[model samples]
Target: MQQVRAVVAREKDAPVTVETITVPDPGPGEALVRVQACGVCHTDLHYRQGGINDDFPFLLGHEAAGVVEAVGDGVEGLAPGDFVVLNWRAVCGQCRACLRGQPWYCFATHNAAQPMTLADGTPLSPALGIGAFAEKTLVHAGQCTKVDPDASPAAVGLLGCGVMAGIGAALNTGRVGRGMNVAVIGCGGVGSAAVAGSRLAGASRVIAVDVDDRKLEWAKGLGATHTVNGAQTDAVEAIRELTGGFGADVVIEAVGRPETYRQAFYARDLAGTVVLVGVPTPDMSFPDIPLLDVFGRGGSLKSSWYGDCLPSRDFPLLVDLYRQGRLDLDAFVSERIALDDVEAAFDRMHRGDVLRSVVIL
Candidate 1:
C-alpha cells in the first residue's frame, strides 16, 4: 500500500481537501500508475458541485499522464516504467457494444476491483474511475494507453479527455473530410480542438463561432481559417456568408445549450452533418424544432460520447503527431501549476481566463 496525497470533495459545495489516501497495489487486471501531470477540468468542478451524482468524499482529477509503476496478473502489453496516458473508458469485452465491434459505446466499463480509501479506511469514489490528482493512482489495466515518452505530459494528457472529444467529434462522428467546410460553435477547449481537427482533416474552410473574441483568437492559432463573433453577428448568417452563402458542409455544436443547438441546426447546409459534442446539464431541455425539419434536413444528427474514440486506435497516433509538431497540442496548456493550485485553476477556468492549468507533479 502507498499513502498518496489526493484531492477529494468530502461533501457537496465544499472546498476540496488534500488528504492522505491509501492506494492498494494492482490487483488482477489492474495497474498502478505514478501520475506525472494532471489537467484541471470542469468535470472535476462538476463532481465537487454534486452535478455528477451524490457520491461524496469523491476523489477528483481525470485528464492525466503517468508512468506505469506496476502491472497485475493477466495484464498484457504494459509493464513497469512505461509512459502512458490514462483514459476513463475500460471496455468490457462481453458488453453488447464490444461484442458488436463498437467498444467505444461499451455498455459496461470496469475500474479497479480494489478500492482506494481515506486514512480512516473509508472508501473513496475516484472521479470518472481515475483519481490522478495524487502522486499515484490505481486503475484497470485497459485504462493505460502507452504513448511516446518524448511527448509533453501536460499536452498529451489532454488527449485523454476534452481534446479527444473535440477531435473525434469531427473526424469520427461528423466524418469531416478533405475540402469540406466545417463550422464549430463554442470556442472553449473542446470546440477549439474541433477546429484543429477540422483543419487536420483538410477542411477547405474551418469557421469558429463564439461569443468571446479572445477564444476566437485562440481558435485561429489552432488553425481555424475563419472566426465568427456570435456576439456581433448572427452565427448562422455569418457561417453561410463564409461558406459562399449556402452554409457549411458540417456544423458542430460544442456549446450544449438550446440556443447554440438551434444555431447548429440552421447553420448547416441542406444534408450537412450536425455533431453535438458539448455536454448539457440535466435540467437543460432539448431545443424544440419542427418535426418535419428533422426528417427534411436530410443529414445526420449525432451525439458524440467521448468523441466516439477508441483509445487503442487514437492515442498513440495523436501523440506521434504532436511530437512531429503537426498537431499543436501545446497550444492548449495555458499554465503550469502545482497540485495545490487546482482550486485556483478552477476559478480561472470559470472566469474564462485560461484554456487549461496543468498540475505538474
Candidate 2:
C-alpha cells in the first residue's frame, strides 16, 4: 500500500478536497498505474453530487492516461512501462456479450478486486471505476489499453470517457457513413467530438446546435459545417433548413435533456438515425410522443454507451490519428490544471467557460 494525494468528494454537493489516500498494490488481474494526466469531466461532478449513488467519500476523476508501474499475477499483454489509456469497460471474456464477439457491449466488466481507501481505512468508491485524480491508481489490467507513447496524454486520455462517447455516438452507434448529413446537439465536449467524428467519417454536412455561442464556435473549430444557436432559433427548423429542407441523416443528442432529445427526434430526415449519448439524471424521463410518430419514423433510435467503443481496438487507432494530425484531439483540451483546482474547474465547466480542464499530475 502507498499514500498519494487525490481529489475526494466526502459528501453530496460539498467542495472536493485534495486528500491523502491509500492505494493498494495490484492484486491478481490488476495493475498499478502512475497517472500522467486526467481530465476533469462532468461525470466526476455527478459522482460528487450523489447523483450517481450514495457512495460517499468517492475518489473522483476517470478520463486518464498513464504509464503502468506494476502488474499483478495472471496479467498479460500489458507490463510495467507501457503507456496506456485507462478504460472503464474492461471486458470479461466469458460474458455472453464477449462470447458472441461483441465485447464492446460486454455486460460484465472488470475493476480492481481490492479497494483503495482513505488514510482512516474507509473505502473510496472510484468514479467510473477509475479514480484517476491521484498520482497513481490501481485498475484491472484489461482497463489499460496501450496506445502510441508519443501521443499527448492530456489529449488522448479523454478517449477514456466523453471524447470517445461523442465520437462513438457517430462512428459506432449512429453508423455515420460517407456523405451522410449529421447534426450534433449540445456543443459541449461530447457534442463537439461528435461533430469531429462526423467529419472524420466523411459526412458532407455536420450541423452543430447549442445554446451557447461559444460552444457553437468550438464545434465549428472541430468541423461543424454549420452552427445553430438553439436558444436563438428553433433547432429543429434550423437543422431542416440547413439540410436542404429534409434534415440530417443522423442527429446526435449529447445534452441528455428532454428538450434537446425532442429536437433530435424531430430534426432528422425520414428514416434517419437518432443517437442519444448524453447522460441524464435518474429522475428524468423520456418525453411523451405519439406512438404513430414513433411508428412513422422508420429508423433507428439508439443510445450510445461510452460510444459503444472497445478501448483496446479504438484507443490505439485514435492515438495514431492524433499523431498523424488527421484528428485534432488537442483542441478538446481547454486548459491544464493541478489536482487541487478540480472544484474551480467544475465551476468553469458549469458556466461553459471551458471545454475540458485536464489535471496534470
Candidate 3:
C-alpha cells in the first residue's frame, strides 16, 4: 500500500478535506496512476452532495490525466511511465453492448477491486471509480487511455468528461454534418464544447444560446456563428430566426432542465436531431407535450452519455488534433488550482464564474 494525499468528502453537504489515504498496489487488470492533473467537475460536486449515492467518505474527482506508475498482472498494452487520460468506462469485452460492437455503451465496465482506505482503515468510495483528486489513484488498466504526453494535462483532462459529452452530442448522437445548422443551449463547459464540435463537424451556422453574456461571449470565441441571450429572448424563436426561420438541423440541450429541453424539442427543423447531453435531476419531469407533436417532429431525440465516446478510439485522436491546433482543448480550462482549492473551485462553479477549475497535482 502507498500513502497518497487525497481530497475526501466525509459526508453529504460537507467540505472536502485533504487526507492521507492508503492506495493498494494494482491487482489483476488494474493499474496505479500518479495523477498529474484532475479537473473539478460538477459530477464531483454532485457526489459530495450525495446526489449520486450514499457513499460516504467519498474520494472525489474523475476527469484526469496522469502517468502510469504500476501495472497489475494480466494487464496488457499498458506499462508503467505511460502518459494516460483516465476514463470511467473500462469496458468488459464480453458484455452485450460490447458484443454488439458498441463498446461505448459497455454495460460491464471494470473498476478497482481493492478499495483505497482512510488512515483508520475505513474504505473510501472513489467517485466515478476514479478518485483522482489525489496524488495517485488505482484503476482498472482499461480505464487508462494513452494520449500524447505533450498535451497539457489540465486541458486534456477535461476531455475525459464534459468536453467529450458535448462534442459527442454534436458529432455522434446528433449526427451533425457539414452545412447543417446547429443550435446549442447553454454556453457552459459542455455547451461551449458542443459549439466547437459543431464547427469542427462543418456545421455552416453554429448558434450558441446562454443566459450569461460572459458565457455567450466565450461561445463566440469557441466558434459560435451566432449568439442568443436566452434570458432576453425566446430561445426557440431565436434559434429558428438564426436558421432562416426553419430551425436548425441539430439542436443540442446542454442545460438539463425541462424548460431548456422543451426549447430544444421545438427548435429543430423537420427530421432534425435533438441531442440531450445535460444531466437532469431525478425530481424533474417533462410536462405534457402532445404525442402527436412527437410523431409530427419526424426526427430523433437522443441522450448522450459521456458523449458516446469510445475512449480508446477518441482520446488519442483528439490529443493529436489538439497538437495540430485544430481543436482548442486549452480554452476549456478556465483556471488551475491546487487540490486544496477544490472547495473554492466548487463555489466558483456554483457562481458560474469559471468553465473549469483544474487541480494540478
lDDT of 3 by residue, 1-361 (tens): 8999999999999999999999999999999999999998899999999999997989999999999999999999999999999999888999999999999999999999999999999999999999999999999999999999988999998888989889888988898899999999998999999999999999999999999999999899999999999989998998888888999999999999998999999999999888999899999998467999999988998999999989999899888989999999999889989989999999999889998999999
Candidate 2 vs candidate 3: which has greater lDDT?
2
| TM-score computed on alpha carbons, candidate 2 | 0.99
Candidate 2 positional error at 105, Å: 0.8
Q: Report how far residue 19 has shifted in candidate 1, in Å.
A: 1.3
Weakest ten-residue segment in model 3 by summed lDDT: 282-291
lDDT of 2: 0.95
Alpha carbon deviation, residue 29, candidate 2 (Å): 0.5
Instruction: Please give, for residues 1-361, the per-residue lDDT of candidate 2 as tens digits.
Output: 9899999999999999999999999989999999999998999989998899998989999999999999999999999999999999999989999999999999999999899999999999999899999999999999999999988999999999999999999999999999999999999999999999999999999999998999999999999999999889899999999989998999999999988898999999999999999999888899887889889987989999999999989999989989999999999999999998999999999899998999999
Off by over 4 Å in 3: none
Model 2 residue runs over 4 Å out of place are: none
lDDT of 1 at 228: 90
Per-candidate total of colliding backbone pairs: 0, 0, 0
Local distance difference test values of all predictions, in order: 0.93, 0.95, 0.93
Model 1: per-residue lDDT, tens digit, 96-172? 89999999998798899999999999999998999988999999999999999989999999988899999999998
Query: Residue 267 in candidate 1 has what lDDT?
Result: 94
